[model samples]
Target: MTRPNRPVSTVRLAGRPTQRSALRRATQIAMALSGFLLWVAWHRGLMRCDTHRAADRFAEVLQRLGTTFVKLGQHLSLRADILAPDAQEALASLQANVAPFPPEQAVQEVEAALGRPWQQVFARFDMHALAAASIAQIHRAALPDGTEVVVKIRRPGAAEQAETDMRILRRIVLVMQGLVPSLRRWGLAAIVDEVAANFRYEMDLSREAASVRRFADAWRGSADIVIPDVVDGLCTPTVMVQQFSHGAHLHGLPSSTAVAAAGKLVDSYVAQIFRDGFFHGDPHPGNVFVMDDGRICLHDFGIVGRVDGNMRRALVAFALAFVEQDAEWVVDAWLDLGLLGDGTDRAVFVPVVRALVADCAQRPLKDWSLSGALAQLVAAGRTQEVRLPRDLLVLTRTLLLLEGTVRLLAPEFSIIEAISRHTTTGVFDEPKSAASQRLPYELGNAAHALPSLLARRLHSVLRQGDLLQLSIKPDARMLSGIDRLGRRVALALVTLGLYIASSLLMQHGVGPRWGDMPVLALLGYALAIRFTFSIARSRG
Candidate 1:
């Protein structure tokens, strides 16, 4: 997703002192710590939020932490399997309720981004903001052509503040890792990097406009969903203008109506992810609205995802493996996606995956908890030395979010069942026979990849044919062992020489009896080092 460079209204921040920012961060940390301490102090007492029906309190705390933390909470909210349902629902509210900047700042942002007066750009623009969030705020405007639209204005220094908060978050993650080694397998660092990368893209409004156009074009004829038309001339890096949308927020919609709408939405989103390999990465309820006619209008194309052909195939394989109850195939799919550790023992991993699948199958997905699944999966992965990739975790979050949103409409809907029905009907699978008939569809996808693949192949051919090549004659492994042994022997010899020199100097009364223990200690150390190395060498 892209953001605009110009904001509707600008509030030039007086270069706030570094101390001010530090103080703000310190204050946030102190508040967070205070909350944690209060929770701990009453964790087993009557006032514990976890024990009481007080999910709202936890959500309130997360929102108070500001953008980065709110985003993290939104991510956590996706894990319906792990978090209590009440808490997840509360956190979902943050998708739209996070703090907003002033409308004057938004107008200034639009003016600065467009490099012209707001009046010159839009025939009539409302100064009041329609909505505000951590990243940007929305305003209503009318174009010279008499078309009504909404403009999204990126907040001033939003990107810089997000980056700062992310750095602080990294430290928090590092501390968490130290306290919990199992976190290493989660690839939290990579997750943070991905979130940062996507958020950076979101900070650019132009990119969001382009992505919105892309989605609009891709789903042009789709009746179940709507992607707003981008107001090309009115868009900038700091601001984006799109066709005005009208719909009831998801929470306000009837459950049955929401379910039907959500089902189609899920189907469309899954198709985009699995079949088209391009997906809107963020699908929070706030980014989605249900029109009066039952069409789902997706907003904020700030975070999209793309999977390569190979990864798409692996995903298909994973689904197939799930259907077939093939543990080996599941493991293979995991490996295909680079979700396994180098030292992982296949023997142990295969059965673990099989057991996990069986356990998962025994329960309906609607009842699944992300945290519980992770705990089980992580426990198994550690025992089997499997390491799940960060992206897969995000993918898991994506699915959970989709499922949660779907449940908001239809509480009893079964994701696995839906997937099975689709797969079995060949809705997701394109048969070879169909490929022959649908050559255009196949070619369209191929055309996207052919250029890069051809270039890579040609470059590889040229490199092998003419590029300089150097060959080494030494046996690399053998040479490495020899080098290591030589270093150890040389160090031992030097130590002996030093010990002798020190002893002589002491004998000549140039030094005290410090030479006695020092020389003996050096010799003993050398002998111990040699003994340990020999033992390891012998074992090998």
Candidate 2:
């Protein structure tokens, strides 16, 4: 097949700022205003200092800051593994509802994005918004073809503002990384980077449309889920057209039905995250509704979670470990994901793991302190020099959101029970009718034996020299290079420790140290120098 060769333009020329840049600038201004508000709230005694309901105030602050900060808060709420429970609870209360932009402005945005007059696009377009949030607002419209649908239009300047907020957020995160040594180990900076990347993709409606299609394909045969088809040729980075649905939100269902629905939702969430590994990251009540036909209608495809084949396979083991409360297996899974300290004392980690498992097991399924336990373990691990992967934080975030929604809808639903049920049938054993009659131990044995058999056969083949092999020879220079790299790594660690200790001394009055403590301002410059020299020496 012959393909046409296209001319490539490599000249770097400054052009008009993109819509994304404008949106970012707006967001930065909004964030600055938000920070000022926070200062005013603190200085004027507007912020209540009450110990109780403190979480509510925190959520309010985020909400008042606008969409980007609220979303940031929502993201933070997921890391109950890092945040205090009350703080997480407060942040989680910042729902995805904000005042709607005016109908006149809404029309302008829609017209601007579509590059046509509103009348040309729709037979009847409602001026009043159906709902509104941080980034976009919704309007009911009937297409010229007479297909009734809802149009979701990105708020004017939203992209630019979001980009700006993200930049501000990145700056804040970088400062935190430099100032708080503990935060670096928690992978906070990497998390912000991931969020920034996702936000960029999310700002494009075409990308969101593709995500919807992918989701639909993944759940083609499922009757319990409803994914709307995108109105092709009409979608753009600023606007999306999709089938409109009318149904009661999940929170309004009957208690029993809601509990059942909650169970099913949890099942769906876990299956999507661990089994399929491609899931809607935003699953709040606002993004879900229960149709008359009993199917769950999921909306909002801006943020999502994904796991490759390797992570997917590891998740099966993680689920199994959670089911059995096996600390060793869980740690192994964490290690597989690069979520543990390389030089951590295994003995120290075991006690912490044991404590965490015991804490979770002691609580009721609906009340399980999984986040608290994970948070404690994570905090303790940091004390022993552990590092967690960015994905683990994302996983923890998803679990927190899932568990919170479940608790709100059904307090009696046990996460442990739900997980055990799924592990036995969904992951460990093949599904069967009346499967409750089967012994779990028997299923587990069967599952284990297959892998054991495969391992033995592979060992026999290796013993008989049936497998090909290769060996590499290393020269003296290579050995010297390896030794030098190791020494530089050791030096970097020592420098990091000194810099960290000095930072703490300068920030807080934490007893006197041997040498005069340097200013926190100088620590960052010192770290950059140390890191650069270490790398340069290693390369030399």
Candidate 3:
């Protein structure tokens, strides 16, 4: 099946502004954003202003500022902790609609990326773009063998522009944080750093290609969902070619088809998070399509999220607790997830969460909204100074986007019910019996090693003539401090081990390589760094 080419609005590519230096870029940003910054200072420091109006103006400025700022605004819209409801709503409306660069430029880009004439690669290449966004534009094309594919070309000067924008954004964040001490707690600088990283990832088409391949591998035999296959030997940093997915957008499907598609969508997402731990982060309506064969096709793999084992378990517990209307358990789950801040007032936080649970429980399945409820919970947490993990926030945004698409197809679809079914059906349930069966063997192994461990320790103490002196009074506070120190030491040791192993892997060229380094080595380094920061944060 092939999708018809649609007319896309084209504009002469007025490329990104080239700034000579960071200072020059910073100056330009200041001039562009001075009004909004001053308004924020006055509103926050002096008389309060209407946040809705302020949010509208902020969105307008971001939209006018170009791609990087629009992306930042979209990210900020997901932060329920930092923004008011009205502000979130306003920012959520920010779209990345832009005129497509001329087809000649796209042709030049593809030929350059391929290092060959365009006719050698494609039997037919559409001049008109299939779609255009801030980061890239998609065009319909066909291989020499007549295999239908889509070509995605990165926007000209996007990388340089993003780099410049991010530098200026960091400076702005630093200035804002210094001016308002309270802004430090919100981690504005950290947010900018994260946005910069994600933008860089998106700019690298090879990463998105890898993501699509990974998803396809994960769902290789799935009958209900379809992932487009990437064209091997064609993907590069600025260009990607993939099988063209053919289906009607979700809104265009018939009611029955849409409802079935909705069910498949919910099931696929549940499996992605609970079973696979990796999922498409942005599953908005435009990215979802209902196939003529009643299968669901997911497009756009640029943004995705991963759930670690701990987060998956916490989410399962949270879903079960929410289903049972056990607010205390919900709070416990959040605490277990390490979302509650040190200054969180449990007395107030509990009541707020309890009320939200009560309200959700009272509503009919069709009327209930998992995303809205979660958003409200996040907002409530914000009020009590609770902080949520970025992955959780991303998941919340994913659910919000999924719900909107689902509603268009099946207005009565119950996300809560779908979650409950998945959780209770052993899809996410751990095998308790298997763990119980392994307990005896684990204990026997531990018991067998205990005497050896004890002998070594005892011999060391005896050799040092400290065996008798080892007996000492145990103070509660002292023991607690020692326990904390021991945990930190263990964590530090593990982190060191990971770094060493990763370095060895990199040196030996072990495992699959991404770019210059081994993928596993890269993962090991990332995990090690995360642990290092965790240790630092705990000490602080």
Candidate 4:
């Protein structure tokens, strides 16, 4: 029920609305945002003045405002780059749980989505909600065939309200960006837009059905874990139905069961992150339930996170660096991950990073200065005015959650130990040579070679001036390659020139006319289009 993500939606209003519709949306947004602000003001006296308290306050406000804002809060929880840790931590409550909407409205939503009365759709449809949440409510029911299922019904008017709220937030964020320049650096507008996309995805329940189906396909025949199967011919934009897991909730599971469950959860995440490069975005205890037979059931697909191949490699590098206690390796991993920019002050940054690695290495998992190594690294980056990417931040938050839950169930378990065992394996494909492992230390120990290396490099630099190198374009052996490149360049230039000439000829009707346009120009246009696609196909 807490599936929400990305903040980019603030600026992304749905539809090319008429002026009246725009005005109506604007008014709705204004009223909604204002009410949220009022709630914040009222709660401030009992809250801390820092960003953490502010975040908790914001979530409270969103819950009060209803589904759209609550959904927004859930997305905000993942945007660690945009918000401080305290704020992110506070927003996580949205993912943990949301207040239930009334049961009668849930029935209406089901009826509206299915285009029939609940009685017709199911042999026994439960009017009472099994669990109620911001976006949707879950209810236990059975088909005429006696197949048990849970129907997820979106809150009525969620889409319309989310769009309005997103639009209003966009306008407000833009205004704030202009008025308070610091806000622009945080990419608040982009964050809001992402949240809008998340809301939009969740608002369309069919997408969730597809996501679960794909997840199931990915893990086919895996007996250790379970992803609920979607009900065929039973999904709409506002509602979806999936086969329910007859399992104990995570809260009710014994600690002994939890220990085993935690290990399964970690292994599942490893498969999702390392093998497939796609994963369930939020793997907190709330989204997990343990069956009596001990199989783990994962719920919610609207907020899955994806890391492409390159990012997965970077994560592997980071994990390896931590295992080796190579501070420089971790720093390099951060740079490769785009969490630290080229312009960052590495001289000042290195010591701060080394200290962080040292501190985490020396401390207990529960006593780490920040949530975990990743969070502390991000925190250090924040201190040095560096910005981490949103994807890595989400991964960090995810790993931290996993670590906490694992510890609760099995205090003796260590994800770090698991990571060290896997880092040297082919699972992640990272360079595992001793040279790669001790690269920074090798450089550090080779201080005597620095002067000779610099002298040789400087001599080479003096020998090959930039202008001198450019003057010698194509060497004799490379002439064929150069010729091929030249042909591509010539083709591109010719296509552009022909395109311009055709447009001019058609505009002035300068050549033989066909349908009041120049036939020669038409021919030229056709030639340009053909060549353009030819070039694209060749590249592809």
Candidate 5:
């Protein structure tokens, strides 16, 4: 497959803006933002106010700012570590339903991308947009061979406009940092850079097409999922053509069908995160459709998340810690995952996260919410100066959107249950039963071989008459360090084994019952938590 040219750096300026034009744009943005801030202050200071209303007005201002700021708002919505819940909710509206440019401009973009007249490219191309967003708009079209497809066209001058906006934003961030030195700790510059990079990546439609292909390959043998096939040779940086999927939106499905489809949707996402380490970052209701046969169809691959191996392990550990309700383990896993900032106060951060997890764990299984707990944890991070990983933030955003979508389909559906089921089956990692069962046997074999090996070494030393002359001097601190390392490693292994066994017992419905969970499993979890606590203490 052909790939479009990838830019060396997304933040690179497309073309230098004239001094007058730059000044004018900057002045316009400053005036709009100042007005909005003043309105917010007046409304909150002098009249009845709520975050929701303020958030809505904030989103409106961003929408009015044009594509770059709209995209920024959508990006900001994903930062659970930065924005409050209401602000995130309001900013999410920027994801879709943006005003579109003229059809003539869309047509012009298609022609330019394809290097041919619009008439020569398709048998029928609808001038009307199927959907429109800040960066692009979609048009329903058919190839000369009668194959139905959708053409996604980038708005005219989107790249140049994004470049200019990003430059202004970067300068603004610098100015803010200079004025308020404390703001530098928040890494505003890094945030702006990330936004610019993401916008640039989305601008290249070819990358989105490639993402769709990868997802299709990942789910090739799955029966319950459908990824639209890309129209090869028709994809370009500005234009992407893929088979138009036919299905009802999730909201249109019956409750029964919606529940089943939601399960499959959850399963697919779990596999994407744990098995594939790649996931659809933006899975809002608009991008999800349920086919007549109940297969879930995903559209618009513009935003996707890629997790590395270490991050996947960290996430799996996090899930394990969550299920076990071991707050210390949760904090440890997060810290191990490098989610903490340099100046993070563990004394404060740990207690906040612990309280959040305990509250979530105390809820009834049917009422449990993974997304809510995660959101709270991220919000805590913001207050405690903990920096969540970018991939993690994206995952949180996916789960938040997924939860909303699932709730719309099946109000009583428990994401916690789905995640627990997958965890029990070892979809996120190695099978707990198999690993727990095999570990002891492997350790026994090693133990059985150690005596003979040690005896032989001693006999050799004696035969050489060097046994008495052999004097071993070990550093006290080194030995202490080794001992601590060994103890922690052993504790981790035992705790993991216990947790796995507990999950197995729960899965097979073994032992007595404790509110739907096996009693033995519950005990096992308790023991695992105790061991985790011991490990944490040892670290101190």
Candidate 6:
């Protein structure tokens, strides 16, 4: 699934900012943000846009400002909890509805990117962009051979504008750090970093071209899925040419063939993740189209995901464990994926996951989803101050969107049933119960009897001089414990030393008095206070 970027007319890569220009831009950003915040407070409540009018107002301003501001709005639209539904809707419109650049400028961009005249490269090219977005615009064009294709041109100055905007954002984050004091810990900084990466990635058309070819290869010879063929000869760092594919949005409404279409999409995505290990990161309806021939057309390869063998296996184990209601296995799989943070309590985490899975599994497959379950797991992990890998967050969001998209199209679709399509594909060995796989299998009665006989003989044969070797890597929990203990011990030793020095100085009266106290004693007490304060700060 793919969501288009913010709409823009022109995006030239900008030049370095002079001090005066930087100051002017900084002033503009401050004034705009302050006005927006003040307007929000008057029109809505704190931290949320409660009414449609407020949502519309905030959205209108961001859209008018354009570029990075609009991009930020697009991201905010996904945060339903912080914004009211109407607000989310209002911001989402910016994704595809922002103002388009002049048609002549779009043509110039294409010509410059290709390093050739427009007529030479395209037999017939549409002057008007098919679509305009924050980073780039798409135009319908035909190659010299008359093959139908879509050309994506990077918006002039888009890169420079984004860079300038991110610098301003970091300044805002720094300001927040002083006020809220835990904004970084809240992961807002991480979110901004991802946004920066996301925008940069989308701007690189050559990267997107490569991903298109990769997806095409992954589904080579497949009839159920369509990946547009990239015209690499015409592709450039700022421009991409690829085959055009069409399909219905197929969201919130599904035709009679929807069940089959939804099933195929789900099956293909599961393979992309668990089997092929490369997937589309954003799977919204806008990124996917249903061909008239019942084949699904996947689009927007700017943000594809790749999973190595170990991660793929771990994800499979996690999904199966969830379906099987195996809490321990779920914890283990999360541990394998590095989703759980340090000091995660297995006892508490196991029960929480089991309860959540049990409640979710109570619903029929048609009404069930892993999204809520995953959200709960993530929230629980956060309580322990566990730091999860950022990539896991992206993957979870992608899968959650995919699940919703599939269900929206076909309400009765079953993900499990769809996964069976590749049961024979050998992405995984035949699945078995975790318990059975973890333990040696029981064979015959002779095998069962041999274990007890061997135990008695081994005990008898064990002697004082017998050699037994065992080696195990250190546990994470053990290491964390040692680290904390070391810090505390160091603090305690320093505190004791300070106390002794202060007592000795007081007894001996070693230096000039400060009121009734010796200078040496006063210095020792001051050092102790500083040390104690440092220790407290570290713990906090």
After TM-score superposition, what is the CA distance of residue 526 in candidate 1 from its true location, in Å?
12
Check candidate 3 and list the clashing pairs: none
lDDT by residue (tens digit), candidate 6, 1-540: 222343442333344666787778777877776787688776577556554466666666676565687887776655432344456667866733445667788788788888889999999898777887767889998888879999988877777777787788778777877777755666667667767877787778898899999899888789899899898688887889999777777864446768878888888888788867789888887887888888988888876777766677788888777767688898788768765345667675787787877776677765656656666666667566665554566576677778877877787787765654455677566335566755665545558799999887678557543437455788999898789879977987998899899999999998899898899898888898888888777772
Cα lDDT for residue 511, model 3?
94
TM-score of each: 0.64, 0.65, 0.77, 0.68, 0.72, 0.71
Please identify model 3 stretches exceeding 4 Å from their true place: 1-24, 40-52, 431-540
RMSD of 1: 10.4
Which portions of model 4 show Cα errors greater than 4 Å?
1-64, 94-108, 115-120, 251-256, 340-342, 364-371, 383-387, 430-540
Write candidate 3's Cα lDDT for 201-273 as tens digits.
9999999999999999988878899999899999999999999988887766777887789899999998898
Error of 3 at 378 (Å): 1.1
As a TM-score, model 2 comes out at 0.65
**Against the true structure, candidate 1 has what lDDT?**
0.69
In order, candidate lDDTs are: 0.69, 0.69, 0.83, 0.73, 0.81, 0.74
Query: If candidate 4 were superposed on the true structure by all CA atoms, what would the RMSD be?
Result: 14.3
Q: Regarding TM-score, does 1 or 5 come out ahead?
A: 5
Best by TM-score: 3
* Candidate 2 positional error at 429, Å: 7.5
Candidate No. with top lDDT: 3
Instruction: Give the runs in model 5 whose Cα sits over 4 Å from its true position.
Output: 1-20, 36-57, 95-99, 430-540
Q: After TM-score superposition, what is the CA distance of residue 121 in candidate 4 from its true location, in Å?
A: 4.0
Residue 194 Cα positional deviation in candidate 2, in Å, after optimal superposition? 3.9
- Candidate 5 residue 442 C-alpha distance from true site, Å: 21
Q: What is candidate 5's lDDT per residue for 1-540, written digit by digit as tens? A: 222221211221223467787789788787777788789878887765654377777787777676678789988888888788878877766633456777888898898889999889799999989887667788999999999999998877678778888888788889878987998988899999999998889999999999999998887767899999789989999999999888997776777898998899988898888888899988889889998888999987888998887778878887778777788877776666667476766565577677877677677765766667677777777886677777788888888888888888888888778888986677776534567889999999989999999999999998999876857688998799999999899989999999999999989999899799899999999999999999999894
Please, what are the lDDT tens digits per residue for candidate 1 over residues 1-540?
Answer: 221121112223222227678568856855684576467558636554454334555656655666666776666555433455566666666643445666667777888888888999889888778987767888899998898899998878777776776776667667778887987866677667766776787788899899899889888878798888898787888899999988888786776886688678878866786776778877767778888888888887776767666677777887777666677887787567655556765565576776777787788665644333333444555554455554565566566667667777677876666666677555467534555868988788899999999999779978788546655688889898888878767666765665566556545645233534554444555665665566456443
Lowest-scoring 10 consecutive residues by lDDT in candidate 6?
1-10
**Distance from true location, Cα of 516 in model 5, Å:** 84
RMSD, model 3, all Cα superposed? 15.2
Colliding pairs, model 5: none
